[model samples]
Target: MNTYDPAALECLAAIVEEGGFERAAQRLNVTQSAVSQRLRALEAQVGSVLIVRSRPLRPTHAGQLLLKHTKQMRLLRADLERDLQDLAPRSPGGARDEERISIAINADSIATWALDALTPLARRNLPIEIITDDQDFTQEWLRSGQVLGCVTTLKQPLRGCRVLPLGAMEYVAVASPEFAKSQLPDGLSAHNFRDVTFICFNRKDDMQAEFVARRFGLKRVSLASIFVPSSEGQVRAVAAGWGVTVVPELMAAPLIAKGLLVDLAPGFKLQIQLYWHSWNLESEVLNALAEALTHAAGQSLVA
Candidate 1:
């Protein structure tokens, strides 16, 4: 096939990301009719359907393929512009304009040490946005342009993005002092609490149950598990002696120190390897933030 029309593909992708031709026009500072015409020309050039004309429009498979390439092109262009600027004479009021950046990260990091890594960026007053969700699904958002960066568990980079290992977040099995006294076995065996109730962050959370199974030599647990969504609530539930729960080292540290909860085992550990994934662009702001996160992770976790 002939080389794809870069300009037309960009316009089409912008339309998809902005949700409509009118919005895309606003972003590109052009007329809506011009955006529509460009899209039609793109479809003709590609010889396939590229979009679904539905509310909050969706990209067809071909559209998605083109959209991914267009975004990479955008990032490359931005980097080229930066390099060109560096070669030019400094403009008046010399600081670069603030660029908006969004990142997707897991909730535990939000509550614990992620903020510390983010502290320098906050001090610089960078226009940064954070989208918090389960680690397993955060990379899916990065695939679209919803976030330009993310902290993900996946070692591999998503399409059009690069990945850098952040570090491992450790988790420990814990329970309230009172609850442990009543529910745990005298010898703490694998089959000790075949019927003990436990607290779980959500269906996506298998931390506590996994610890139990590993400690007991079972593939899975059939015991009663309670679902609690909030990080604070899960820890509080364990503190209240409601049940046992496995919590991140950062989350369980203070409570364990205060004697609100006790470690189920002193040596058991769970570490999730994290990565900082972002568009492979040359924006100074994005690069600075990446450095800040890496520095923070180094200090906080076993990178």
Candidate 2:
């Protein structure tokens, strides 16, 4: 077995995190030449080019694998340190240190009930770095080791990861009362879809389009559309009568109840099943976070 150098692994991780050798050197408090040399030595030992050396440097397949290992080791070491600290005697007035856990989550969930689920962790002074993407796509972040866990639409567990269903988030097609009266007077149909504008979170978001297609039976229907990337902004834009949009039921319910927005299709709804995916590590923090999130989801989401 080939022995891996810890320093080299640290250098590789820093390079990827900082996006270049010079920046990595700055972060590692080393010279640029030193960073380059360590990477060369690591690649030689592993017999693979770990980094692509591109603008905004990227990790190769081998580099990503090693990076994943490095991150997992860091988590385990942090857990061990916390355990040891619990057993050690604390000095008077010693300040507690905060630890960070990275997670990937969908914008809709973040805008809805996910943040509430994480309130317990925040209260414990544990910092979380959230990477936001569509639930359908967050799985890629988990595969690349960018996050320790994710709330995604994918039910299949990744290798070294465990998954649990968190229930489905229901969405309703809604628009401002005025817009609904003017554009969807006859309700959502292929006839009026051409005149009605649609609001999309981003180009990658196809939920609104999918809903239109499913309800109207037009697979390739084209309508005037506006891109509003933020989850709250999407609701605000629709509420301002910019266009009709689909919003999570948890968010839309209040607006609909307040008469600020009207549900275009009352009986029809879009349901997205959410799953929590996390590294299968025996760490108290990870398990606690999962439990808190699961409990919150049970209360907030539909069965």
Candidate 3:
């Protein structure tokens, strides 16, 4: 196996993560010319084109493998930092941008328990970037090696990853009190559900259709939806009477308790079982993240 330069690998990660050669150079405290030279050198050494210089830069397959390799090295070094913190903290002299610990988590989890779970790590100045997507799609970030771990609905382990069940989060169909009373007066029955717009986290989110289908026993279900990319944004939209949404029970609970948001169907609970997938390495950073998420899930999610 040919050994690659660490600086070259950092250049690759910076370019992808920062989204441009200019930004990568700024992050690395290097000139744009230096960034291009390093990337070219790395590609020449590997004898492959690593990047596709498109509108938004993206890595080619060989580049993705190198990026994944870079991420694993970062993880190992992060673990080392954790271990050495008590003895001597590393100098914060150079570009720490590439040191970010990236994880893909469903937005619902981020709006709910994931942030609390990650508080300890964040407080200690761990560079963390959360990539949010639908629960079903978060695993793709891990599959592509863009993130070290992810919280997703996928149970089948990815190659070289370990899986941990984080319990099931119950999703409830909720809307503002006035909207429910005015529009869904019948409470999302088979006859009236079609009349209301369902607010979704994004196009990839199908929780609204899933909840309605399972609740009403329809093999095929479709919903008219407007997208709200953020979980908090979804809540705000529904609260402002934009539309009804299927969200985690915990997210809707406080509002439900406050009589701001009403649970449309009290009898039906849509539980999405969540799993933690991470690189199967004996590293403290990954282990801590897993433990924190698992513990928080046990308390908040249904067993």
Measured by lDDT, the strongest candidate is 3
Summarize candidate 3's per-residue lDDT along 1-303 as a digit string, tens digits: 999999999999999988999999998899999999999999999999999999799999999999999999989888888888889865544327667789999999999989999988787767788998999999988988889999999999999999999999999999998999999887888878889999988888888999999999998888888998999999999999999999999999999999999989997889999999999989989999999889988888887
CA shift at 254, candidate 3, in angstroms? Answer: 1.6
Give each model a TM-score.
Answer: 0.70, 0.87, 0.95
Clashing pairs in 2: none
Write down the RMSD of all candidates, one decimal each.
5.6, 3.3, 1.7
Across 81-124, the per-residue lDDT of candidate 1 in tens digits comes to 45566576335343321123557988788878888888776654
Best model per TM-score: 3
Cα-based lDDT at residue 12, candidate 3: 93
Q: Which ten residues in a row have the lowest lDDT in candidate 2?
A: 90-99
Cα lDDT over the full model 1: 0.75
After the best TM-score superposition of candidate 3, give how far the Cα of residue 288 lies from its true spot, in angstroms: 1.1
For candidate 2, write residues 100-219 as lDDT tens digits. Answer: 367899999999888999987665445567889988899888898867899999999999999999999998899999989987887777677778888988888888877878876776
Instruction: Give the candidates in order of lDDT, highest first.
Output: 3, 2, 1
Candidate 3 versus truth, CA RMSD in Å, comes to 1.7
